[model samples]
Target: MISAASRAMLAALALAAATVTAWAQDFPNRPLTIVLPYPPGASTEQVARMVQPILQERLKQPVVIENKPGGNGSIGTMFVARSPADGYTILLTTNALMTIVPHVQAMPFDPLKDFVPLTTAIRGILGLAVNPNVPAKNMAEFIAYAKANPKKVHYGTAGIGSPQHMAGLLLNREAGIDLVHVPYKGGAPAANDAMGGHIQAVIATISSTLGQHSAGRLRIIGIGEKERFAGQPDIQAIAETVPGFEATSWLAFYAPAGTPKAVVDVLNRELVFALSSPDVKKKLFDLGLPAVADKPEELDKRTREDHKLWGDIARQMNVRAE
Candidate 1:
């Protein structure tokens, strides 16, 4: 026998549970938005556009992409962090905002607390490319050249505190060279400057410099991966020349924290399917970003590990947001 108040409390709990279940079941009955925290021409936007139609088809709703670029990706990320947790709005961004940015800048939202990891879509390859005029043919030669020149060797990157910047710093520490960092508004500009001989070298995503490298305008000497990238085996890993050196980037999906688990499951299922498609895989590979459709748990684990890894590196390198 229960008191009247106790009975009412139990009934209320049951009603709440039923309501949540119904909400999850009816999710995305309206339009869904994928928020990208970068400019229109970014690789992140390209990837989002690639999957938008597939996600819409599978979810039986219109999926829209919204770009909110600023503060090195924090502006749009905060927007999603504060969005309703109904799974209507999700974030498609790089690991930099979560793992690297917070270590250097003051963030408005807590990365580990404000969002839930969905899955990683692709792995971006960052490469170190030099002007064709540079006499360095490979990583070893480039290191020697930089060592000989000291601070005279200048390397450009997307911006200060960016992954490319960190890679350049790591190379400086590992190779014992003093390559001055020239921060640019974006990777394309940085690569363009390098090609024009304005900068001796540029650390940026391969997609931005691959064409120039192939055209002999800029020469990609090494990549920031533990092993050679399969698509371009000729380019050696910077790790090969400087043991234990690696600085890679990836793009992943996330929803605001407290989004229902059932809704997350639905999203994960469709995302995995779209990413696993052969068409998508080939397109991503051609763009120098290989598809990686790992499970949500795997993404979560990777995020946590990278957060710690980058934090340690930032402390060691004294990296601060510019």
Candidate 2:
């Protein structure tokens, strides 16, 4: 039953499969690039630099970091989305790009559909801090103060529709306070303004606020985790006072959709290995970001969960992207 034409077709199919397997096995013939959606000094960039060396070592190839910050991280993210799905160009960014921004602004790419989740590297522990001049020692006091002096209780965030901003939005809803949002170009500016008392409060990662809090220029009121952040044990969780109030940002990696499964596996394995190093873990802890290198499936699950959670909040609060 084997005609000449059928034999040719079978031979071609077998050769194609063999070619794909060989290609996968011979991946990364050149340098790999990790695209950062925010400018340098942003949390994602910090973590990427931390792991870059480890990745280069594991892959035996140069690992480059490219920053393309804009449109609330959408610009760089979309750039990666449109890149070749050959696994050379990867995306190192925060969950906000996929989880929160889409809910507020129109996007050029569908985050949920355009990228393949690689892994989440770290969880940035956020905290609520107030200027020393504010008459608030804790979340309750701050909420009460904000209620009484709504106009004076403005809070600074990394930018409009950022994770910091979303946390502030959630706090406003749960604590029944009206803290005005003052968006800045980045966390550094926001923290600086908060330290100078130009802004009354700031809800940013503990690392961003730790120096000011330690110098007594800013008073850390509460953390934004279910439990106290490890780096700042004295500060209480915002949930302690405003029950069910918890929000945090995380850094994760992604590759363009249709990237071969074999390539994804290599990246994920190396990433998990890099983050599992003791030195890397300690560095992350010192920076107030806990290492959380979970499986790619877990990142996908969390992305979906957070996307829905923040989407609901965005709709309720009528948040619009600037």
Candidate 3:
């Protein structure tokens, strides 16, 4: 009872489905590559290396890592986005490149449409820390001090449009204070400046400055999570004082768009299994990046939500990268 054209269209769809299924079934016949958008020795690269053996063992393929660092991770990210959807070349990068960078700069690739998220591998919480010279003991006193000082109080971050920078901007809006932003080449330098009293405050990963905080070199006033980090429960969350401030950073895996669902599922399964391993979990935790795993759809949802959230924050703060 169907027209000839309709019958032909159905036949085409069925053929395409079969083709994709066969392609997925034959995936990773050779070596697989994981591209990192940053230089070697970064946390992202470390994580990729940690899971490389597991992936190689499970898939029976050599997992090669390529570092194509430049343009704030866009160079490498774009490389993965343009790769064939054969699941051979993958991307491992931080949430900032996907969720925040696009909002602040002109990117070569579309974050939402160009790639399929495999899963989030690990996450870390950012915190606001101040030099011991700052007359602030906690979030409340810090807010009060900033209100009194205005432009006189300065905060340093890794760079403009970085997660730490965004957190500082959010704090400005949420707490109604002006904390001047000083951009540095990296978080470690920023934290070092804060400790040297060259800057009054710094928004950095809690672990990067935790030792300093414990030694009285820097004082961590508030973390950028809704709740205190389980690893450091003694520190209060910024949200506890600012009501809705949060800035969590994470690393995730992705494949080029149009990748078959079956192939994506296979990668996700291996990733989840590797991340759930006890040794992997302990290593990630020791590095201050707690391992996490989720379904592809969950990662997609989180990516979309974070994309929108960061866009809103960037627009509200009038933040644009140069």
Best by lDDT: 1
Alpha-carbon lDDT of model 1: 0.92
* Cα error, candidate 3, residue 168 (Å): 0.6
Question: Backbone clashes in each candidate structure, one number apiece?
Answer: 0, 0, 0
After best superposition, candidate 1 residue 114: deviation in angstroms? Answer: 0.6
lDDT of 2 at 239: 97
Residues 212-239, model 2: lDDT tens digits: 8999988989988999876778999999
TM-score of 1: 0.95
Model 1 regions lying over 4 Å from their true place: 1-14
| CA RMSD of all predictions | 1.7, 2.1, 1.6
Least well predicted 10-residue stretch by lDDT in candidate 3: 283-292
Query: For model 2, what is the C-alpha lDDT against the true structure?
Result: 0.89
Score every model by TM-score: 0.95, 0.93, 0.95
Positional deviation of residue 133's Cα in model 3 after best superposition, in angstroms: 2.0
